[model samples]
Target: MKEQDTVDLFVIGGGVNGAGIARDAAGRGLSVILCEKDDLGEGTSSRSGKLVHGGLRYLEYYEFRLVREALIEREVLMNAAPHIIWPLRFVLPHSPDDRPAWLVRLGLFLYDHLGGRKKLPGTRTLDLQRAPEGAPILNKYSRAFEYSDCWVDDARLVVLNAIDAAARGATVLTRTPCISARRENGAWSVTTRNERTGETREFRAKVLVNAAGPWVNDVIQRVAGSTSSRNVRLVKGSHIVVPKFWEGANAYLVQNHDKRVIFINPYEGDKALIGTTDVAYEGEAGQVSADEAEIEYLMSAVNRYFKEKLRREDVLSAFSGVRPLFDDGQGNPSAVTRDYVFDIDENDGAPLLNVFGGKITTFRELAERGLGKLRTFFPEMGKDWTHSTPLPGGDMENADFESFQAKVKAEYPWMPRSLLQHYTRLYGTRLSRIVGEATSVDGLGRHFGGDLYEAEVRYLMDQEWATTAEDVLWRRTKHRLHLTEAQQAEFATWFSAEMREAA
Candidate 1:
């Protein structure tokens, strides 16, 4: 191994938790490297329900610490990346058959006060018969409750963390898997193979962080050749996207007969994203998909409350991801805790920190706390600072997204409103970097489809570590949902040729 390749830390995942930890450690002046087997957030991080909420149902499980921590993190994350994380109101229709109104009210009350509620409004009792938000609900539900939570672009959140980590002097390697890691002479000898180039790299690190999400155990046993008393439970959650059925910005949460909750949220400007059935899964996390039975289950859940019924044909797309919850001897998958657990195994003075379960909302805090556990080893590292810092492209004045949009519009009056909004929503303060000196849509170079132009593609390739067509279409942005099949194929062909030429 080359002496120059030695570092203080090596993180083995590109999901939210892993990326967040790399960013935190790098910002604290630690030498860091983050490796991902696939694209950033190609796993559970991107497939989430996309809500930065303090799981209200967890209240029934008495997970107060997790709920409170997540609630507090909502505002903290919004301030960090206001463009992608913003407050959203959810309307819950009263269904007396599922639970009593008082129980629901009590849960809302705890949600409102638990995290030092500020910026977001408190809960309100709604008269569904009279309110505009109730227009789409069936008249049988005459009452509702409205509360606040935040929505996030999940995949982008992971990418932005990686970007920030790189900016802070962290080496980030995507499409690279840690092939082997072993404790030798009180240090970790790690080896990774780049899938695209078929190149192998070696490194020596003082500490190893295994934030591999669904593959946590794989890294522990297979890669590091170590064992842990802790185990990970794989739980599959799926979501379906369809055309917008309702006319409001607020989302709807309905209680199911199985004592679970379903979220119907507005998505990608004229689409509705509904989802999430929790089933204990034993299959490979990478090969998981929404089956017919799961799809029918989701459709039935949505049809129970909305006036516009959802049919099989209405689903435009469906995706599934597996959550690696820490096995706590829970019988029901839904009852599994979303809280994170860290197990540090010091094998002959070399430490391997294996991160178990964590949701997106608390990733920053999780990173901070994870690093805190390693303070005795690196006491000279910098103190916690991510709490008040703004992420890249999120440094708008006071984190005001609307004001930033107005500024971008003033700067580029010739840009179409739809495309401008797309740029601002995804890039925030970095819109100018993507638009450059382009005076009109024609200046943006080739138009793939919808709002996707060649300039944005180049920016993604140059700055965001995007390589494949799928990386740009699905994760970096949701252009896949807007473009036709032929347009997609054409874009893929063009992108491959351009990448080959650049290489």
Candidate 2:
């Protein structure tokens, strides 16, 4: 973090779009700096429904292009990070009240053919009365459609992009908010203050990029003192974590009376991640949380299809994110486009690229296209190269995570099954960075309850720029859900001492 540093590009906001653009620019042989007021993926990027789907429902809105591009990127991303992104079979029970079976069939048909889906199985019809996947569902629904989509660790995807960017000679500043930016002699002068250290540094960037998700307008009007006619529609979508009640590995998508669809997916090992209600939000982005109605709305959607009822006591935790959708004058929040829009403001000669409205599934593509918009400024910059490139820790051959998992299991015969899976899933090929010279459970260093270990914590701090306990537990990993309150507090105490000692 040198003061008065100059680079080819300076990216503000370290969410998926920001990190992805940073990674793309750095890999294309450009010097880059990415700053975030919070940890990477601490915003909407981490709060998604955790799916890399083609937005199956968007088909009804005639969003064929968006769905097709997303569908194609589904496998592209799955191949890029097989450890975090894998195929998920969603059993969408056909409901007579909301959507007719024929219409649902047509949507699934388009979903199958639209993306040139390679690597994933096609759609199949299932008889809910006889199929094992429907055992948990009510008997009233006798038919369902099974289709393919990919599950993603949304938070890790953002971190991996940042990691890749840093590896490619980009400087990443976390907990550092860009306070000001202005055109200065054919270049942009930016100032940022690190929240943790209270240290301010200056940068001279040839081009400035605003990837601030919900705060896109804030950065443009407030921070940069620049204006853009383009506006972002802030829509808040929330999800809840509850115990996995279903018996199979399959997930369920049920239609709601409001014409919205809810997904009930198996999450973490013993829990389920269910969510996403599209509601126009006016509150601050950082203050967004799952309201009682949203939670009940989600639970009720599940109860409509599942025989195993989910009560209020069954909910473990809830989270929400504010999606900064490109305002298209669509009054219905659900009708808003999931596709991204780029607005490049040429402030004299320096350029500021503002990204708006994209989904987790198409982040890489969004990033690539975003860089393409600024090709003229840096004509010497390298050509596009992220489509086939692998993110950090996603270097398995052909992205075969199952084979990689088996290989690691054999190497560490003494490691417990759950711990091994946890390390592999979160770190992929980079698991060795943390498990270096570790042979047994004790080799992993102090156990802080559940599968959490000091070695992993140290690795995260050393590699992932994790500054706070919440960053490590909630963002870097989901240990917050597993550790009891006392155990979590104890781990926090140890973490504080460790930080103090390191300082």
Candidate 3:
């Protein structure tokens, strides 16, 4: 074991919240280190609904503050990473059986004007019989409402934040578990073990942050050997991916018989991403998986509105995430608050900040505010600046991805449109680093089916913290969706050999 290295901040968890805070804190000139027990975003962050919108249903629960903050963050994040985070219009097919049209209209009205909405179009009424967006809907849905939100490559978002943090001089250690921590003479002495190498390291930090999402309590009690009065209620949410059934670029939201709404959004250019059941989860967060009942429930919601019915065979893949919601004593899991709570324990002159709950939309704001709570401890720390700054690969001119994409099309005219899109959308300005001087498809080295070329794989391994083939296939990129089983097996074999050679 190496000698203990001291840092200003030590963050536990590699989810969006943890990565976002690490980026924000590092940019403000704080010496920081972030450790994740598993692969980056292998936890709850990647298994999200992937929308960067204020929870519309949250409005019904009178979460105005959370909704407004999320709404404002939508545009802020959109500008920060236009490639991964872009506007998505949702068509809500009016259901007379679920809620009154007048009430729906009022909610839409508030949603249109609630937060600082710039760069995104406002909500408008849709004539289901005439509008193009309603072409795939059932005849019973005569009217619909359209509103704007943003979609994110949720896993990539976490990776980008970590990348930015690393670029700004923060140490990011993935697949490293913080085994123990103790307050020692007004500082935290933390020990972490690397799962892959079986090497343990220690760190001394002035402040410790637990953003372990679903594992928050486990870290509080088991890892740190401390307790907090605040608690996290684990609410499981799931999403199913299937081939794209509807037309146009619009997504659909339909209310289920149980009053919960399900999102059927266009995904990965050729598929639909449908989700999510809010069941109270009590098991291990890593073991949380979508059951048959949840899948059937989601399918029923989609079938009620879409003209093209979905079957079990249509489900290409399904994922589940446990929301670490702040326990507000709500009976229903869905009724639990999505708002984040910060519990700061400045006991024995050492500080430990535990984050309870947050959404993808408000992660930046949550990071900014979390840092604000620690300002008194570090009076000389830099001010909040992530709102106006661009994330890594998000420095497109004026945050215009369309124009930048057009330029990429011209530059890589020899490449397939799909491949070009894959690069630009995933890497943005950093696409050149992946492509390099490759002028043709053969220049990209081996073709592993679909758009999984050797160049991109090497770039992911060299730059991104991608070790295992599954890390690249599932989390770092969605290549698994496009590749066949045999092709995936081949890639996995090649990735294993390459990693061994590198070692």
Candidate 3: which pairs clash? none
lDDT of each: 0.94, 0.92, 0.93
Off by over 4 Å in 1: 1-3
C-alpha RMSD of each candidate structure in angstroms? 0.9, 1.0, 0.9
Model 2 TM-score (2 dp): 0.99
Worst 10 residues of 1 by lDDT: 1-10
Tens-digit lDDT track of model 2 for 342-389: 999996898989998888888899998888888898888999899999
Q: Model 1, residue 280: displacement in angstroms?
A: 0.6
Residue 479 error, candidate 3, Å: 0.7
Model 3, 226-326: lDDT tens per residue? Answer: 89999999999999999999778999999999989999999999999999999999899999999999999999999988888999999999999999999
Which candidate tops lDDT? 1
Off by over 4 Å in 2: none
Alpha carbon RMSD to native, model 1 = 0.9
